[model samples]
Target: MATMITDECINCGACEPECPNTAIYQGGVEYDGLDGAKHAALSNDFFYIVPEKCTECVGFFDHEACAAVCPVDCCVPDPNIPESEEVLMTRARQLHPEQAFPEDYPSRFKAGAAAPAASAAPAAAAAPAAPVAAAPAGGATFVQSPLDALADTVPALESWDVPLTCFRCRGEFEVPFQFIKPGTVLHCPHCAGSFVPNTILYRDVAKRVTKFYDSFTAGLDAIRSRHQAEIERFEDQLRQSLQKLKDDVKEASADAALAGAPQKNRGFFG
Candidate 1:
């Protein structure tokens, strides 16, 4: 079954670029499919996944990339759009023909089962027996939030925070959201360095900026084309008017000359 975005979505836009089939779209944006069919926005207030294009990461990844990266875990299986593994795999193949899936590629039921549990057995045995170190004297004890504690226990939860390196000081920091605007500059608390957010720099924000520029240039080109056509039409009309005025002047001059010649003949006869 395809994945869906819940209303709890922060509209951070992290899910859009992670989609292999380009199924995710920002609020109010229209999208077109490879088959030349256009789709309207599903939600005007949050990012939404296109049900037709979403394959739940089948033939691509072991798990859904959007779900893996969402800070609030808003991406979930769509209960309304129930689909079988075969249907999802067919859609994946249709969306990406050049890409090939291995026989063991993940499905909704068998996803992540390919990985052996033998390695985790040793870690699980050592986890409970491991002793927690006591805080040093006069040192304050730090408390962790539920999310942070969960991330510590499960390594997979670490995907929620994306690491970003400061361009000025090279200090590394983690941001909760992956999708940030390119124009948004962030100041590093450690080094006081101001730089653009790197999470969406090459992916979402750059693509959005490029699309806006392309659209703006297209609009300008259309206006210029229309103005040029209008100018050419006006020039043609002015040339026709000048020609007509010249012809009228010539006709009047001819009539005046003919009338004077007859008077001259009369004067000569008298």
Candidate 2:
């Protein structure tokens, strides 16, 4: 019965400080332990929720604290990760050993109030997530956070899953990206192109496109240089052959002139 934040988080840092368990963190920040240490191995690309400390306000208040304060209504129950109220109550006791549930009840508590019933209502009304194959046959179907679900519906990005390539360098590659609303510019290491994720797949496509163009241009330059060198060699050989022919012609003319010297003083026929 842990509470979670959806991708709808505006990163306003509003709901972060309000968590009694300090489970909420800014996008890309690390959440280590109850002591609030950073676990560097975990990525900080987006806001994260720590499951260890979340108690769903079982003992603290009648309702979830984060859901109450969240402006975007992104704080909702995680259906994929379901837990019963008994489990939440036990966890609350572990966290605050001295606290007790219904300690101040004056015996006039409602016979069957619906706080527990309403909590399940939101999850019931929400669309069920696509079941993962690895999950147990009857296990809870893990769905993406609310933000992820919304991103999947956004159009104009259907082909984003296609590989990316760089127009300038012809470099091709795949890149990992997290969806950010209004899509932000991405930097590719291969083609060095800056692009936006129009769809979920755009980031990878852009990376691959950059890589493809880079390789293509390099290959083209190599072929051109090789052909240029061959042409220069052929031209050099032709120049050498022409020079030899000119020398031979000059020798033949000299021999002819020497051989006809005896008739030089003769008439026009000589």
Best by lDDT: 1
TM-score of each: 0.41, 0.37
Residue 171's lDDT within candidate 2 is: 78
Model 2's TM-score against the true structure: 0.37
The backbone clash count of each candidate, in order, is: 0, 32
Expressed as tens digits, the lDDT of each residue in 1-270 for candidate 1 is 578888756665656778888999998988776678787888899899889898888777767777765545667777788888789899999988887788887754573433211111111111121112334467666675443343244222213345678777889886644335466667787798786764546475444433333333333333445557788999999999999999999998877756336554546548
lDDT of 2 by residue, 26-123 (tens): 77666667565666423355455676677666656566666665544566677777776667666767766775557632111134422431233222
Query: Candidate 2: where is the Cα deviation over 4 Å?
Result: 34-43, 98-270
**Candidate 1 total steric clashes:** 0
Clash tally for model 2? 32
Candidate 2 lDDT: 0.55
